[model samples]
Target: MSISGINNYNYQNYYAGARHNMAKTGGEIRGVLSSTSSASSNITLHMSDVGNSGNALTAMGFPDGTSASVFQADDYNPADPEYRVRYWDKEGNYTDTMVKVNDIDPQNASYLEMLAYTSYSDVEGLTKNAFGDFMNAARGVNGNISYDADNIKEKKDYMSMVKELMQLQYDSNNLPGYLSYKELYDYMNDKING
Candidate 1:
């Protein structure tokens, strides 16, 4: 039972009564509801309830959901372990990532915290260096990436000097890049940092 057929709402008291009745039935009233007596009209405006999804927000008038936000304002915090930004750079030889360098405040860190960019290709070498540091834990006093004697390659003179210093090489040729690359990259990180 909707009192919607009458559009000529000529009085203040009657319009208020209709609005009040609509509220009681739990039906949303959108658009204009007004009184002919007042110069100002009653207008109902609403935002499409976008429940935290970027795509959904984008559909509701935000441009691809790239709105400026606090999460987008997080500075690079090398100390914060929970934050990570991933970008696709199939154009480059390396997977692109941007790591902010700081410890995030525990009280304020949210699901949508911190901002990062992966399109900074000019810094791939530098970015890789930073990621290498992260993977090797070479950023602090608590971390010390080292190779055991068995993992080190023996020099000809050193081998001759020490006949017992023989080592079995890690055979990773058959392994997938996921494993081999990680091990090799870790080793490289260790060597570089050490």
Candidate 2:
């Protein structure tokens, strides 16, 4: 049950029949296990076969020809990353293709900071206006400037403040006009933290 130091397994030694050949090349192979049994389980394997002149092919095999397929580098160029392996069927229709994969690298700290600053600057003007309106409404009630109509002025003032904050967050985050409940929560967090 304890598997350690099993870093690599070589399969070139497993091929025995004259129908198969082996070569050393750099690539990956993927397959799936068919069943849970140890002896009767079916396994598929792929191999990169390189000729003497450094040409390569990705040979794949399964239990049947109709179910299994192989992809090989047609225009084999050793130095190019854009080179790919293409698969085809007996009818000459394309099936699958493989290409080099890479991940995005995050190395520009200054650019990230500039993006954050620009995002902040783009929303500053709207935030200021919203804050001003909320403060004015709050002051109108506190100063008794609207005494005649109703005392719901305090509630209205608080609602306006909430609306202003919500708008600020929404506009800053570039959220859609129709706000979802989860989006509102995320906007609040991003506004407070970012």
Candidate 3:
């Protein structure tokens, strides 16, 4: 199971559920916690090889007293209908709460303010043209036959876009005190290719 909130992808709870199932079946299960998530999201892996107990917690690769993840209250946003987490007070009156993401999100332990994102469809306005170019490329690049485009502008434009993206990565510097694109790219390649 996967849950996506804005940019956060919560996958740690998946192992908790998988642990219960493994306990029931008396066998281990392998699972990828998530396909995508924020760079620092905590990933969990659980196994019940020796059966459930305090040892099971350690066997599952979690530290002692590690609590299972819970359903989090959504972030607060006055305008977004889904953002505000409404709760009933002790007196039974409904009220909106202004909770920081860290209050609910395990990943945002520093209590950073809630973030908002604009989710675009697969073919956004900018990608619409690129989509057309891709279809053209696919149809033209069929097996065994070699055919050239009557108009190379689309191909050239795609190459320019790739170049622009590379330039932007280098020009943007990076997060303060964090790896620059060049360092991160080279480091990643070294680790992967080594």
Candidate 4:
């Protein structure tokens, strides 16, 4: 369960570790079909048949294996009561944790949509403050990141504040004189725009 030594991957050893873990966990990879074409010298895969195959997705769709639940992504609205996120517990058991939009981290909002099976609307209600908090924590801005809480309520304004904070942090770091101001500015601009 501890993969500390495998932090950085070496292509040669990754598969060996993966196979060992797979065997130990009784993990089965379904719906993957591989076929090689002799003439074309290529391989093709057909995976359209795999529908909601993950453990959390399966549990949400058919909890009892017979009756399908009424869990519909299209039906989810951010203004609704709450949003539920599915994550694996320490024992490898899938657990659904309901969270409010305010508590959602803006940095991992899209990741939550994919990995946790949360909807876009679930994170649509996140405020500027939440994004600021995520940026601060991620960048280690601490008390250095400053913004007018009352005036800068819009998302765009908060993003500008983040760009400023990034610039401040970059300036604070005493890099070699060879690194030009334009280089850092361009890098920060690209990050902010992206």
| TM-score, every prediction | 0.16, 0.19, 0.16, 0.25
Best-fitting candidate, scored by TM-score = 4
Estimate every model's Cα lDDT from 0 to 1.
0.26, 0.29, 0.26, 0.33
- What lDDT tens digits, residue by residue, belong to model 1 across residues 37-133? 1324322222222333112111101112122111121243333422233221222121212334233221232212212211111133333332222
* Candidate 3 least-lDDT 10 residues: 113-122
Indicate the worst ten consecutive residues by lDDT in candidate 4: 61-70
The predictions' CA RMSDs to the true structure, in order, are 25.6, 26.6, 22.3, 15.4
**C-alpha lDDT of candidate 1 relative to the true structure:** 0.26
Best by lDDT: 4
TM-score, prediction 3: 0.16
Error of 2 at 101 (Å): 3.2
Query: How many residue pairs collide in each prediction?
Result: 9, 0, 0, 0
For model 3 the local lDDT of residue 187 reads 28
Tens-place lDDT digits, model 4, residues 69-146: 112332345454344444333233443445453443333333222222223222343221332233342233344432
Better of 2 and 3 by lDDT: 2
Please give, for residues 92-123, the per-residue lDDT of candidate 2 as tens digits: 34333333211111121111121122222223
